[model samples]
Target: MDTLTCHPCPLDAAELARAGRDDPATGALGEELAARHLVADGCDLVARNWRLYAGELRGELDLIGVDTAEGCVVVCEVKARRDASRFGGALSAVPPRKAAKIRALTAAFLREARLPYPRVRLDVIAVDLGRDPVLHHVLAAL
Candidate 1:
């Protein structure tokens, strides 16, 4: 990807709005695929798109799942691409601000759902869902 195409999505209210709408479809596919991949790696699926509401604060978590013997809640954001990049497409999709939102969402999920977790972490699943689906698991991207 070049300079223009490689730029991160705008973090303003508009992009978040667009992302929220598009996420159900795109994030859903990504989380589902990520869950399957995690299962293959011996992880358990706990939740998808975990959300928490505190007053006016709202948080949305992509995937909340378990890994191995650990009680883990996997917060994921999915990015799909037609072709792979050197750093990988969609890898750059979730920036720091976006990541903060996700993390806050995870925190809310734990508090609202009252789920006990030994450790919580975030992951970004980058996929090229063209001819053949290719997945890249980037654990603890933040």
Candidate 2:
């Protein structure tokens, strides 16, 4: 298991909008913030927005990183929302079905990448872009 640290850095909606003309939503910003948070926690990120399609089964992993201390592959799913009040926060958005799909995708990633890690963990990084923007990390969520 890996320990997580919370940082206080609120994202500026106006700045983000100006920065990326392509993405109108805050999802891209959230993913970037999550990736930075992981690196700050001593995790070496291997891939971002990794998509795998094994026949009819297709899934996309938000972030994939290696925990340097634990020597395990961490598969992260990031959910970003401007207001979490509607959906009970970004963390709660990932239901059982979504979690199962993430697990399946992780397996496919391992098979394709042939990563030699002893352990693989599923994680979720929820980014709240509300009044108090927060980046919450749930380790070994699945």
Task: Show model 1 residue runs off by greater than 4 Å.
Answer: 1-27, 83-88
Q: Write the per-residue lDDT of candidate 1 for residues 13-117, one digit (tens) a residue.
A: 543343335435545555556666767667777777656666766867666677657666666676765444443566767788988888777777777667566
For candidate 2, lDDT tens digit of each residue in 1-142?
6445455656676844533344345678778888988898888999998997659789799999999698899999988777777657777888989999999898888888887888888988888776677788888733
TM-score of 2: 0.85
RMSD of 2: 3.0
* lDDT scores of the candidates, listed in order: 0.61, 0.80
Runs off by more than 4 Å, candidate 2: 1-7, 12-24
Winning candidate number (lDDT): 2
For residue 123, model 1's alpha carbon misses the true position, in angstroms, by 1.1
Q: List the residue pairs that clash in candidate 1.
A: none
